[model samples]
Target chain A: MINPHDSVIVRTMSRMLIPLIQLFALYVLFFGQYGPGGGFVGGVMLGTSLILGILVYGRDGVPCRAARKLMHGDGVGLIIFAGVGGICLVMGGQFLNYSSLEIPLADDARRRYLGILMTQIGVAVDIAVTAISIVFSLSPINDTEDTEPSRD
Target chain B: MIFSFEIPLLILLLLTAAGAIIVKDLISAVLILGSYSFVLALVWAWLGAVDVAFVEAVVGAGLATVFFLLTLFNASPKDTEIRRQPVPFIAFLGLPMLGLLLLFAAEDLPEFSDPKSPASVHVSPEYLEQSYQKTDTENVVTSVLMDYRGFDTLIETAVIFTAGIACALLLRRDSK
Candidate 1:
């Protein structure tokens, strides 16, 4: 039932758009301090990019392997956020208290900035993975079922 | 004791909340709820709580509205009020009890963000003082949300994810 000509155009457009959206998300995450954007906004952008990819590829056209990878990535995101806090606790500070991290830089200012940046990166991954999982899981299953009436 | 613009905005917000509660149409009620959330966000911004305003805008205004709309697709429209026995006496007694509790709580609050309150004096000072130098972040709220109180933020994210998962599971169609 798939049209080869339309498929070619949609695939071409998705290939172009996905990279652009990823780059924009990275910009939002890194430049958030001086701007109105940050991890949550960046995560939503990245999530939407993947959602758009799914729309273009029509289920099977997009790799099932990638979808499985994203589900696993969701757990990784949670671990990263929790792992940083666990390290802080192990160092004798309260949970998520990054000030306790002993940096060789010998400057409190440098250490603090490093800690904040580290936590933000963790948060960015957590949000991005969670959002993508939610979107992927909620996709319209009926459409896929209808499109490929099982060969069996 | 009252300014004109502030009173109007407060009135508008209350009106939106009332409309949201009383509307017979579910979609219209959700729309009014969105309006209430937006007005509350504006009030927070006016009170100089920019971080609270941003979150209210994103979660309450955006996500709540989106969820309501998504559920609408599966929901059959119903405006008929479910008939129920009235309990005016209990409602009247409960209203005063709630008001008294609010009054007592207000008496102990920091006089609308007074600088001398323990909360304002202690936390805000350190957050404002060291946020930039420490986090290299202009947004102190971001530093606090993701760093100082990261545990609480993680729980809040989990709560949202949980709600979304629950909704999807409940709504999922079973194969025959």
Candidate 2:
């Protein structure tokens, strides 16, 4: 079982840093349209932050429930992306044709922008979940150690 | 491109790559490999590929190092121990031959960042020009991936999801 790092400074700093990293990840995800950030990078950063939490505090930083929920997020993201494509297909246009969605979008450009946003969100969710689950699978044996009874 | 900055980054990249391979300890090798990824990311950023650089920095430098370290946790000391053995004859012959082949191929590649290169002269410029107007996104790469080529991203997501599941299945198979 992998134990959390024992250094006080390491744990203290990770506690302070994880939230900031997650915030930056969200910024990268949402502001991707206007900047160098994008779904893939943003998602990677989000996963890295969670991994950092896991490295420093083990299961305390990320509860088992939360991790399991995120494991399912892998499929949720795929469903979201495919469902958006299906919506466009049902709207009487080619699959993933953003402009075909007959919504209350102000313009065709706006429709495209919404499509970009949704697709980016879906990609971000998928990548982040994959990264998290891979790490989780590697370290889950470690997390269960805390629950075991210790012998004197 | 700032030759002053680029030169050092390239040198550091080469040094890190060499150091990583030459290191005796697996942990040190992994750390050096992370630095190599970091320097490569900087080189990509210098070349004006910000999105690529971001992915390289986060995935290559940060997450990959962690993943390697975690994987190492499952490894035993016997697996990590190095044994002195005679170099294989095929490695002696094939390594240099492969290096020569790669060098020969590299010579024919286009010069770095040549605006008139075949890739630049192709449909790339149109994507850059029309991305903002069509998708209302300033980042052309994002628009290209998510808007123009959505199915490719979908497939990519599927692949990543599958990889995660496969990793979980392979690793957890014996535990339960």
Candidate 2 off by > 4 Å? A61-65, A140-152, B88-101, B173-176
**Model 1 interface root-mean-square deviation:** 3.2
lDDT of each: 0.67, 0.85
- The true-versus-predicted C-alpha distance at residue B147 of model 2, in Å, is 1.5
| lDDT digits (tens) for residues A1-152 of candidate 2 | 54577999998898899899999999999999999988888888888887777667755555334666777766788888888899999999889998988888358888999988998888888888889899877764644346766565
Using lDDT, give the best candidate's number. Answer: 2
Give the Cα-based TM-score of candidate 1 against the true structure: 0.70
Each model's total of backbone clashes: 0, 0
Q: Summing lDDT over every window of 10 consecutive residues in candidate 2 chain B, give the lowest-scoring window.
A: B167-176
- lDDT comparing candidate 1 with the true structure: 0.67
Residue range A27-87, candidate 1, lDDT tens digits: 8777666555566666666655665565566555563336547656654555666777787
- Segments in model 1 whose C-alpha atoms lie over 4 Å from true places: A1-28, A31-37, A41-72, A86-106, A135-140, A147-152, B1-4, B76-89, B92-97, B100-108, B158-176
- Model 2 DockQ (Cα-based): 0.71
